[model samples]
Target: MEDKTEEKKVISIEDRIPKLKEERKKKANRRLIFYLTIFFILIACVVYLQSPYSNVKEITVTGNDVVPIEEIKELSGIDDETNIWMLQKRIAKKDIEGHPLIESMTIKRSLPQTVKITVTEFNIIGYTEEKGKYYPVLVDGSVLKDYPMSYRGDRPFILNFDEQAYMEMIATQLNELPEHVLRLISEVSWEPTKNNKNKILLYMNDGFIVDATLRDFSDKMKNYPSIIAQLDPKEKGIVHMGVGIYFEKIKKK
Candidate 1:
């Protein structure tokens, strides 16, 4: 009987030696390429960070009316030589907001070494005199200790109200009025009645007085220009709007 068992093939380590070497070479090449790529990236980062191209070349300030752009830049402590990557936005914001006129501020980094600083400043609607000093009142009912020397004549002078609350109410109301109506106001005085504590009087630049309450001062005062347009421009009198909207011409003696 012939043997039916199958013969097992003999495998030699010498025959597989070339394949093993090829696999090892491929792995080594891959590892070397990876290490070289990592080294190049590290070098590139160092070069970019150390170069002057990474430094802030310009800073633009926007949304500033009361505070000067130079002042804002100075307060931020960032200049052309400042590194854009090293700038701490929170710290810069805090510094810029330290100004009495600035209400809020934001700092942003623009590409190619530029920083933009946008600020929202408190609008000085009018001025109120306390004691001998004249303080500028902001839209948010905040009074600044520094008196405006140049713009004093442009804003209305608030008088006869000693309480800060009343002054704040007047400021808030004036802030809500339109720019045309605000420009028409030459003076605002706190004249409270027995019935309404928010009563205030507005003296117009067109030789007319407005009696309005803080409850609806903005809504009622907006019609002032139209009201003036309807009446005789030469006539000077009180335009009553506290209780009901009407015109009361002062009788000439």
Candidate 2:
């Protein structure tokens, strides 16, 4: 009876081994969680202090000029008092596009509370010589500005399509053209005859006229660099490479 009593006393506490291990495991888990939480909080605080949320420390502009800096800054609503940590870059980006001059904008936030704004301004592709001031024609065909006009430049004249869609199509194609070919083109007259987007008249810079049809457009253009090598500008003629490729001349100017 004495042995049984002592054995029971020892076994009673010892039998709860599973429970003790479980308690230890739970305690360890809680400690691990606490440490991780603390670590994350420290990281967040460090990041916050380094970011622009502390204040609008600096505003930078790149790949932009058409849109005035003051206008972009105003639209951004960024000030020296702004919390660098609390700012959302997308909000500023959307606001920047509100300006007529900005075609697209990218806003990025950098360390030390700086806002880096990268912008793509719309190209001034076509101009109308009106009132002795050159009114710039937008890709969407809406016009802006009243600057002095001169005919000495190689500005392409837009013809054929209506103002709105024409502006966009031309703007898109301008970049795809070869730099050499682009310079040679003095005027671009759109002669879209039902389902033909490629029909155009290129009044070349060398005083030569190109009567071209759009078929094999890029290929034909590639051929032209070699072809022009053989042709001369002094030989004034309709360089008709349209349907049947050849040249025809006017008797006089």
Candidate 3:
């Protein structure tokens, strides 16, 4: 007979345990690696910020014709020493647009140190002469009182406009005309007539003269090409555009 008093041996759960200490060690290592990566990234950023690479190496301006590039750059107040990351775009834009001729401006920063400035300038419609010096007139019908140009190019001349109101009115009328028509006009003189109060005379580059008023000058002048086509090319005359359009031949002067 076997000894029945021997206790049956039972297995503990040690084999089923999930190795908690090893898993904990792995997690701690992963957390350390994450923290180290962030620290290195921050250090690199600081180093780069302190280096010369953060400075603006180049600045460019575009869409500028009348305003000199150097002048625009000077007005922008941005240079090689300006930190690209610290550039104030709005401030730069405001500074550049402070120029009377500049209508609008835009600023952009290119990574790794480049800044680009683009500007749109007001159109120079014509010129007004004073004391042998000429000042440019803008499309808005205002003369650059403080700015005098060295020369008058192909732009038409506004002459004999003693009254500021008449000058402004004529400028507005001229602005409405087409570019081709504008080029044909050499000069405009304020010549009021008894029958017409706002009468003006236009001396055309093609050797023809136009007599009209500020009231409907643009409306009637737009058909000038078609009107002149009906006349003899060799004949020089004054085109009267009023209640009726007629041509008065000027006898050989």
Candidate 4:
């Protein structure tokens, strides 16, 4: 006896072609969308980086007294509209420190749109006479060319000295003196003794003359205030420190 069997139907490739093409089309569309999304994100990032929000809009300067704020700003080369992200702080510091007055400097970034510059300047110790102008002498033993109408602060006048080394030595010695002692000095002259080229003559504001050598100026000058305290203030004389510390009163003529 033959049993009844059910037949299975097979789908032809021609009939499945439309479904395969549709699946491939969907995949291509998905890939295209992914590429377009990445491209848009990259473009957005570039635009954000170039916008005004990424630039330095404000600058603050501090720790400066003698140098003008405008001068420091100009030297730093950092101003409004400068890109904060692209600023090289080290380079800017080097540039600002090139000014002879600036002893040292520091640069810092304060968040998204601000920069801060701090500077320390060399102290002006005295003035040197050249031709008819009085050039500023710094504590570092360097002189400035620009001659102001008048010198600021109480500083000693360096007179009759052409030797740079001697001038520098005088500046170094004066720089190390106490503020009180420095104020007592009215003039400094390079008066070399027959025995010593390092000898100097100082005319004190108190009508006393100091005979000292550059080699021992700083060490010996420190005792000036205490030494003067022991002397008769009414007696104007010469204080000698070249050989030994002594005082010689000038006789009234």
Q: Which candidate has the top score in lDDT?
A: 3
> What is the TM-score (0 to 1) of candidate 3?
0.84
Per-residue alpha-carbon lDDT of candidate 4 for residues 76-135, written as tens digits (9 for 90 to 100): 989777888888887888989988778899988898799999999888788777666767
Q: What would you estimate as the lDDT of candidate 2?
A: 0.70
TM-score on alpha carbons, each prediction: 0.78, 0.56, 0.84, 0.69
Q: Looking at candidate 3, what is the lDDT of residue 122?
A: 90
lDDT for model 1 comes to 0.83
User: Per-residue alpha-carbon lDDT of model 2 for 1-253, expressed as tens digits?
Assistant: 9999999999998989889999999999999999999999999998877664678779888887555687788888888887776776778878888666688888777877788888888866666555566565665666665433444354566555455565566655654567677667777677777776667777777777777654444345545667767777577766777566676765783
Error in Å for residue 165 of model 3: 1.7
Backbone clash total, candidate 2: 9
Best by TM-score: 3
Candidate 1 local lDDT, 1-253, one digit each (tens): 1232222122455668899999999999999999999999999989988999989999999999767799899999998778889998888888878778888998989998899999998788888776667778888677777644345466788778678777777778888888878888988888777977887888888889988887678888888888888999888898988668898889999
User: Which residue runs does candidate 4 get wrong by more than 4 Å?
Assistant: 1-57, 138-140, 146-150, 251-253
**What lDDT does the true structure give each of the candidates?**
0.83, 0.70, 0.86, 0.84
Which is superior by TM-score, 1 or 4? 1
The per-residue C-alpha lDDT of model 1 at residue 115 equals 94
- What is the Cα-based lDDT of residue 63 in candidate 2? 83
